[model samples]
Target: MKKTIYKKIHIIGSVGSGKTTLAKEISSLLGIPYYELDNVVWIRNKSGDIRRTEQEREEYLNSILQSDNWIIEGIHNEDWVSNCFQSADLIIFLDTNYLVRTYRIIKRFLKQKLRIEKANYKPTLDIFFKMFKWNRHFEEVGKVNFFNKYVVHKDKIKVINNAKCIKKYFN
Candidate 1:
């Protein structure tokens, strides 16, 4: 990949919206490290993923933001993560179709359950069902909140449904 023009990139989307996929693609192409918000919120271990304290989460996120280059992706649009949007050289909102996301949720769960895909957490039936609820909530509430909170940074925000568009634009 050529030199990265975008030093800090923040990607936001709901469950199954392809945030991780897009972040990984961009990170690979741009040679920038990517961080998932879930990992920042949890301490992954052999026993189980332990939840991080609020202070710890904030501190961890701050440390990442302090870096010169990074690709941060998550569904979080809360005040705590506002700094990421503000600091990003580019912000991508993966406004994927609701139906497409729903399909992906189902597909992802099945893949994890069948051991075809690796998951950060166990792929339980309960978690699979919760992904649906989370998807709906994001469509109804999180999407709007994300726009309102980051409207000030609209110029740098790219509302995309696919990573292909990003590749074309950024390259």
Candidate 2:
């Protein structure tokens, strides 16, 4: 198998599309640090998860971008994260089927609530329902918007529509 030479990687996908899982796997395989966009966007405070200002978010991302090699993964396609996409040696876009993603989202939430798995945020019913809404939004709107925005970087983008295809990357 050919070894992946990419030093800086970015992954974007709909909720439960396995972006985090793939990022972690690639990080372990390449021994590169992995950062989550959600963590950068929201800071955990004594009160709860408070969203950082746009300037704060940019500053947080800048710190990660300064690193020589990193893997960043999230579902965001906002302007604030465009720099990450531009800097990445490889961009992974997971397009898993809606049914599969929905299943994973439900399973993941249950696991997080049961303390079987760890998550960046506290699992609540509100967030759980929002995941479904986000999933739909990604399928209907975000996918088109992402393709449109990143059309210039088509060469660097790897669109993985099947879950099994991702296994080959690590192997």
Candidate 3:
């Protein structure tokens, strides 16, 4: 069977859902640039991170959407990000297992603390605790919310619960 050519992909999932890792792989394989939605919302600086104004965020996202191809990965499911789902040729919902996500959260925190992993934000104790909360909330609320709100785009949505399954798409 032949695979569809996806120029614009929006990958959504909870923290530690492998969205970034997958985005990078696809971007490298297809030679398409990938973006992290968090980067669009914040201005990262050595001194500290600053939140972008709503207008600025909107404009930044619009610029990417207007491009020829891109892979956007983030956990944001807010109204401000709706256009990304609408414009994407493919919407990947990384329904990674809850236990797996929990493990990743712990492992990631350790790596960040040890300087083995570079984090976009400062890996503080507060943020570490929040990751667990986010994971639980995602399982309890975010998953249902995504399906309910984005049902209109069901035709393009792909629910990936396993990492191994991803290789087939690239092959």
Candidate 4:
């Protein structure tokens, strides 16, 4: 049976997996507020900093989760974020190809540099390279292992494997 889109949705994926973009789209579609974890984590500056203490972060996340409708998007899979998954009506895991995700990341970097796309924080080439490394490593081990160990139940999990699959989900 097709499940109705939930009031609370959580999107998880490796770096550069388009989680933010998809979250925005889904939020718009569902008329729900969308929160990007990076924005909550980093304070904007010429040099960004992790602005929140653990308590502060937890409080902020708790407030958002308490809302009637929301979409939370991030690569974080820590215990703190597990509540999002446990409470979500739908949990999307994007598994786009490595090269595809890399291309998107590079394009996003260029757009941010050109000011075509605004981010809560700027992306340096160093950060871009680090994201690439993380994405590659995620494909090799991190994401798959996490899924196998923690996401064996598929009742609410939707793995979007390609652009077509993504479009299909929206439709």
Q: Highest TM-score, which number?
A: 3
Could you list the CA RMSD of all candidates, in the order they appear? 2.2, 1.7, 1.0, 2.2
| CA lDDT scores, all candidates in order | 0.92, 0.92, 0.94, 0.81
- The sequence of per-residue lDDT tens digits that candidate 1 reaches over residues 27-113 is 888899999999998999878889999999999999999999999999999998999999999999999999999999999999998
Cα lDDT tens digits, model 4, 24-69, are 8887877999998876666557656668888888888999999998
Per model, how many backbone clashes are there? 0, 0, 0, 0
Q: Could you estimate the TM-score for every candidate?
A: 0.95, 0.94, 0.97, 0.88
What stretches of model 4 exceed 4 Å from their correct place? 1-3, 45-47, 167-170
Instruction: Assess candidate 4 and give its lDDT.
Output: 0.81
Q: Report the lDDT tens digits of candidate 3 across residue range 3-86.
A: 789899999999999999999999999999999999999999988899999999999999999999999999989899999999
Worst 10 residues of 2 by lDDT: 162-171
Q: Over 4 Å off in model 2, which ranges?
A: 1-4
Clashing pairs in 1: none
- Cα displacement (angstroms), candidate 4, residue 73, comes to 0.6
